[model samples]
Structure formats: structure tokens, C-alpha cells
Target: MKQFTYVITDEAGIHARPAGLLVKEAAKFASSTTIAKGAKKGDLKRIFGVMALGVKKGEEITVTCEGADEDAAAAALEAFFKANL
Candidate 1:
């Protein structure tokens, strides 16, 4: 498994559009993906799970990848966060 934390820079945080986009990006990977904020954790591939986390601006979230393609998934997602989050 590979994981890293990101502090949301978007004023709107992970709202609907971004959440949907995130789900799509995560789905492109073979690795299982998950995101966590404090005690709350959600599957990154599931839109509702991501939205339900209630992540806010400047909040730290840990994105985790596990499975065969975890390394590539982690690298791609890191870039995704830089570009989108």
C-alpha cells in the first residue's frame, strides 16, 4: 500500500464536481483507493463515499492505494491532486 496526505487548497473543497472527477480518476487504476479525514474513511472509487466525508478547505486527507498497481496509482493520483484538488 502507498499513501500520502494532501491539504485541500480549493475554497470549495471536494464538492460534487471534483468528487465525481476524483471517482473517475481513481477508477482508472487497478489498485484499490481510499481517502481518509481524521476518523472518517471513504472509498475513492465511490462518489457518495467521498462526498460523505465532508472534507473542507485546508483539511488534510490521506489517499491510499493498495494492489498490483499501487505505485503507478499513487504517482498518478499525486499529479491529479496537484492538478485538480
Candidate 2:
């Protein structure tokens, strides 16, 4: 598994649009992806699951990936968060 942390930079945090984009990006990888805040973790491919986290701007979250494409998944996700929020 690979893990990286990122802070939400957008004012709206991980709202519908970005969350949807994240889900789409995550789906492209064969690796299992998850996002975590505190002790809560959810599948990154599920829009509702990501939105339900209530991530806020400046709040940090950890993304983890496992399976065959874990490294690529982690890099893509990191870049997405960096570019989008």
C-alpha cells in the first residue's frame, strides 16, 4: 500500500465536482483507493463516500492505495489534489 496526505485548498473543499473528478480518476486504476480523515476511511471511487467526509479547506486527509497499480494511483491522486484541491 502507498499513502500520501494532502490539505484541501479550495474554498468549497471536496464538493461534488472535484469529488466526482476524483472518483473518475480513481476508477482508472486497478488499485484499491481510499481517503481518510481522522479515523474514517472511505472508498475514493464513491462520490457519496467522499462527499460524506465533509472535508474542509485547510483540513488534511490521507489517501491510500493498494494492489497492482498502487504507485501510479498514488501519484495520480496526489497530482489531482495538487492541481484541483
Candidate 3:
């Protein structure tokens, strides 16, 4: 498993459009991806699960990827968050 923590930089946080894009990005990986805020964790490939977290700007999120493509998945997700969230 690979993991990275990031603080949301976007003023809108992980809103609808970015959340949707995030889910799509997670789905592209063979590894399983999960996003966690404090004790709450959600499937990164599920839009509803992601949105349910209510991630506000400046809040910290930990993304974890586990499986065959964990490294790539983690890298991609980190890049996505930096670019869009």
C-alpha cells in the first residue's frame, strides 16, 4: 500500500466537478483507492462516498492505494489533488 496526505488548496474544496473527476481518476487504476479525513474514510472511486466526506478547503486528506498498481495510483492521485483539489 502507498499513501500520501494533502491539504486541499481549492477554495471550493472537493466539490461536485472535482469529486467526479477524482472518482474517474481512481477508477482508472487497478489498485484500490481510499480517501480519509480523520477517522472517516471513503472509496475514491465512488462519487457519493467522496462527496460525503465534506472536505473543506485547508482540511487534510489522506489517500491510500493498495494492490498491484498502488505506486502509480498514489502518484496519480497526489498529482490530481494538487492540480484540482
TM-score of each: 0.97, 0.98, 0.98
Give the higher-TM-score candidate: 1 or 2: 2
- Per-residue CA lDDT of candidate 2, range 10-73, in tens? 9999999999999999999999999999998889999988988999999999999999999999
Off by over 4 Å in 2: none
Q: After superposition, how far is residue 55 of candidate 1 from its true place, in Å?
A: 0.7
lDDT of each: 0.94, 0.96, 0.95
Give per-residue CA lDDT, model 3, range 34-84, as digits (tens): 999999999999999999999999999999999999999999999999888
lDDT for position 68 in model 2: 100
Ranking of all predicted structures according to TM-score, beginning with the best and ending with the worst: 3, 2, 1
Top model by lDDT, which number?
2
Clashes of each: 0, 0, 0
Candidate 1 per-residue lDDT over residues 6-71, each given as its tens digit: 999989999999999999999999999999999999999999999999998999999999999999
